[model samples]
Target chain A: MELLKERIRAEGSVLPGNILKVGSFLNQQMDIALYNEMGKEFARRFSGTKISRIVTIEASGIGLACITAQYFNVPVVFAKKHRSANVSGDLLSATITSYTHQTEYTVILPKAYVRPGDSVLVIDDFLANGCALEGLVSMIVSGGATVAGAGIAIEKGFQGGGDRLRARGVRVESLAIVEALEGPEGIVFRK
Target chain B: MELLKERIRAEGSVLPGNILKVGSFLNQQMDIALYNEMGKEFARRFSGTKISRIVTIEASGIGLACITAQYFNVPVVFAKKHRSANVSGDLLSATITSYTHQTEYTVILPKAYVRPGDSVLVIDDFLANGCALEGLVSMIVSGGATVAGAGIAIEKGFQGGGDRLRARGVRVESLAIVEALEGPEGIVFRK
Candidate 1:
């Protein structure tokens, strides 16, 4: 986690409107080595937990979930996000509001993938407003599965999403949590 | 490659409109073990090639690219698909028409990631009309990088996308090439 925090301090730029762009290493252009390290850390954190499946939202979260799933030895089921509210009986869908795009999109997972009594561990790149994570948790619950907590790479603590989930008894683990992002003083990590 | 072919024949379903759904393993619900094997095969096929980076499109391709990148020991850069044409000067954008979705979207890759003299290996889950692959190749070329061929998990050979790219002198190695999709007889693979 220190390594990730350091990398964020070195390369991450704070854009206007609370956007922490770690696109250089975390999301867009991925560093697989770092991803492996993060995966190992995630595995260590949730070692004793029963994680039957690793679920994530599409696009950025897919790689991290896939790499991290290798350590857990579990299959990763990524929910697909659609711009429209198209749903079917065969699929479990949830509507999520994106803090970045300011849009509401529907995220869906096929019913056949999530089975009853499955303990799902949610993995994602950034946890800001927690809407995406909340939507994934709802889908897992709807499918008669248990929430096995979440492993996030970065969390904006100032946004208060992770704490809200923690208050609700959801074990959310964020590798790098930015407590504050000052304009001239740079990023401040959660100590 | 044989393992991948076997998986397709056993689990892949031929949905209506010539759609081969291998979501159970390759994309939606990912099998990490199989992905590791496919990654090894990709490294073997492109063994002597100078692959500085592995490029792929977002969502499905991210997992595959990241898994395969471990074998190549190179970074993975995934292009993000946006509904609108909101590209900037720092990004290389391409317009691609999806054969499945029947919609056109803009795929953008950061210019900073693809450097000049870099040899990029394009990785994707499926290749149908080659529009997505072509767009990715153009972006790599636009950034002055050389295409060190592509490594695809599945190619609908009947769709002619892989063949078209091969005809253009690009080295495309698909793990499983589907020759035909007979509804009654099941899926057929190229020998």
Candidate 2:
């Protein structure tokens, strides 16, 4: 986590609306090396949790979930934001509001992917309002699967998504948590 | 490649409109073990190439590219399908037609990610009409980067995309090449 925090400080930029852009290595463009470290950390944090699969959303979370899945030696199932022709069969769905894109979209996963009694670890790049995480967890629950926990690369602690999940008895682990941030004041981590 | 072919025959399904769905392992629900093998094969195929970065499209390609980047010890820069608020700065863009989705979308990558003289390896889940690959190559070329080669998980050989790219002197390595596929005839692989 120290390394991730340092990288964020060195490369991350603070924008309006309390947005922290770490596109250089985290989201738009990725640093596989940093992802490897984050993967190891997630694996370590969730060790012995009986994780059967790693679940995530499209785009940003795919890279982190896939890289982290190698450590768990499990498959990754990413929920599609939109229904496509390729995605058929019965699907578990949840509607999520994206604060970044400012739109509401349905996230779905095939029922066959997550069966009864299966344990799933949800993974994503950022957890701001926790809408995406909540949507994924809802789908897993609907599929009769167990929620092992959630693994996130960066969490906006100020937004309280991580704490809210924890308050609801969901185990959430984030590599780096931004306790506070302002455009001119920079970022402050949750020590 | 034999492993990949076997997986396709066992799990891949033929849908209407000549679509082959390998969602069980390749796209929807991914098999990390198989992806690791694919990554290793890609690295071996393009081992000596000077690949500074791996470029891929959003969603499906991110997983494969990120996993493959580990072997190359390089970063991955996935083009965004939509312009998000987080994605800032000048970007190189290309329009792509998705044969599966039956739509066209613009793929953009920040100019900073793909620098001049940078050697890039393009990775994707599937190569059908080669529109996506062509768009990615154009973006890379626009950024003044060199296309080292391309790595695809499955290539619809009957579609002629692979052959066209090869005819243009582009080095394309496909893990599994589906020579033919029909509703009742099942799937056939190229020998």
Candidate 3:
């Protein structure tokens, strides 16, 4: 987590409306080596838990989830933002409002991917308001699967979404948690 | 390649309009082990070529690109389908038409990611009409980067995309090329 925090401190910039831009290394342009470290950390954090599958949303989360899935030796099921012609069959759905895009879209997963008795670990790049994470958890639960936990690369602790999930008893393990995004003064990490 | 072909023959379903759904293991639900093999195969195919970076489109291409980057030991830069508040600075852009979705979208990448000396290898999950690949190639070239070539998981040879790219003198390495998709007889791979 220190490495991620260090990278964030070095390259991350605070944008208006509480947005932390780490696109240089995290999402848009990915560092696979960093992803591997974070993936290993997730595996270590959730070592004892049984993870049958790893779930994440499209675009950003897919890379991190796929990398993390290697440690668990499990398959990754990404929730599609919209239903496509290729994705056919009964699907478990949840409506999610994007924190970044500010648009409400339905996220869905094929029912056959997550079945009863499956332990699913959700992964994503960022957890600001946790709408996307909650949507994924909802779909996994609807498929009769167990929510092993959620692993996030960075969490905006100031937004309180990670804490909210914790209150709901979801084990949300975020590698780097930003306590405050004080402008000019720099980011404050949760120690 | 044999493993990929077997997975396709066993699980890939040919849809109504030439859509081959391999979501079971390729895109929606990803098999990390299989991806690792494909990554190794890509490394083998593109061996001896100097690859400085791996480029891919967002969503489906991210996973394969990330996995493939491991073998190349380079960072993966995925083109964003749309501009977001998080992505800042000058960008190189290209217009791409999705063969599956039948929608045209502009893909953009930060100019910083691809420099004049960078040798980029484009990676994608599926190559149908080669529009997406061509778009990515255009962006890389516009950035003054060299196109090291492309590594695709599955190329619909019948659609003429991969061949078209190859005809353009681009070194395209497809793990499995589907020469034909017979209705009842089943899918056929090019030798």
Model 1 C-alpha lDDT per residue in residues A1-191, reported as the tens digit of each score: 99999899898887777778888899889999999999999999999999999999988899999999999999999999973222223889999999888888998898889989999999999999899999999999999999989999999999999999999999999999998886566798888
Error of 2 at B87 (Å): 0.5
Model 1 misplaced regions, further than 4 Å: A83-89, B83-89
Which ranking of candidates, highest TM-score first?
3, 2, 1
lDDT score, candidate 2, position B174: 94
- Residues A1-191 of candidate 2: C-alpha lDDT, one tens digit per residue: 99999999999988777778999999988999899999999999998899999999998999999999999999999999999999889999999999888899998899999989989999999999999999999899989999999999999998988899999999999999998888356788998
| Residue A3, model 3, lDDT | 96
lDDT of each: 0.90, 0.92, 0.92
Between 1 and 3, whose lDDT is larger? 3
Candidate 3 residue-wise lDDT, B63-165, digit = tens: 9999889999999999999998788899999999888899999989999999999999999999999999999999999999999999999999999989998
Task: Report how far off residue B169 is in candidate 2 (Å).
Answer: 1.8
TM-score of 3: 0.98
User: Lowest-lDDT window of 10 residues in candidate 1 chain A?
Assistant: A82-91
